[model samples]
Target: MLTGQTLTTPQVVDVANEHEVGAFIGHHTLAEFHGVEPALLDDGPQLRDMLTGALAQSGATVCDIILKQFEPQGVTVLALLSESHASIHTYPERGSLFMDVFTCGTVAKPWLAVDLLAQAMGAADVRTNTVLRGDTHPCCQ
Candidate 1:
């Protein structure tokens, strides 16, 4: 019972003299950043700037950035990109944060964006996971 806009779509192709459609392919990077300074995690505007800058540097076109500051202490930064999207959710009390950067097509580097964000935040430990989404091989002709 969930509905939302999809970032990519299947493409039409010809395979074996017939018709075989291909799935969408994209790069998604998920990371957990630990040991960051607490103060750094609570600043909404600062986090927004950092994420957008990182995405731009990684060759992603940033469409818009949304930031939310929590009651006690925390911030969430979401960057809407032409390719896809990127986000950061913080836990200031624990000095940790979760990040995600997903991009469609080969032009943007999601991994590089994660690296830049981690470096800018000066995280002591960063655990990351990269996923190749959709069909690995597309037979578009």
Candidate 2:
């Protein structure tokens, strides 16, 4: 089980074996940001840069990106990476941000992206949940 802590590839493989999965394939990390800097959430351009920088910092290959700014004040950015995808949604009024970083293959680490995002957003508090995606355990189905 992933405890929202960074895991080595060998550790993940061991988890896969324990769970009866053929192999550890990929994982996803969901991070909730509370009390983030309001400007970071409200500014589309800045948020875009932050997200793009986070992806690059995590060693993800950016394939395509879409950034949308809301009418009142908010932004949503999605980056489709070669490994998988990373997305961010912000609510400036509530001073909250939600981010998801999913990466397939062993080359990229999703947790690294999450860490970078938390720092870039200046999150006062963060809650993260990570799950092993593509676990083929029969009991899990």
Model 1 gets an lDDT of: 0.79
Deviation in Å, model 1, residue 110 alpha carbon: 0.6
**Candidate 1 per-residue lDDT over residues 26-100, each given as its tens digit:** 778888888899999999988998898899999999999989999999999988998889999999999999999
lDDT of 1 at 71: 94
Off by over 4 Å in 1: 1-23, 137-141
Once superposed on the true structure, which residue ranges of model 2 sit more than 4 Å away at CA?
Answer: 1-11, 14-24, 135-141
Candidate 1 local lDDT, residue 41: 99
Q: After superposition on all CA atoms, how large is the RMSD of candidate 2?
A: 5.2
The global C-alpha lDDT for each of the candidates, from Candidate 1 onward, is 0.79, 0.75
Q: On a 0 to 100 scale, what is the lDDT of residue 124 in model 2?
A: 74
TM-score of 2: 0.79
Query: For residues 1-141, could you state the per-residue lDDT of candidate 2 as single tens digits?
Result: 232333333234234233342344677888888878787788988888878888888878889999999988899999999888999999999999888988776566787787787776667777777667665345555
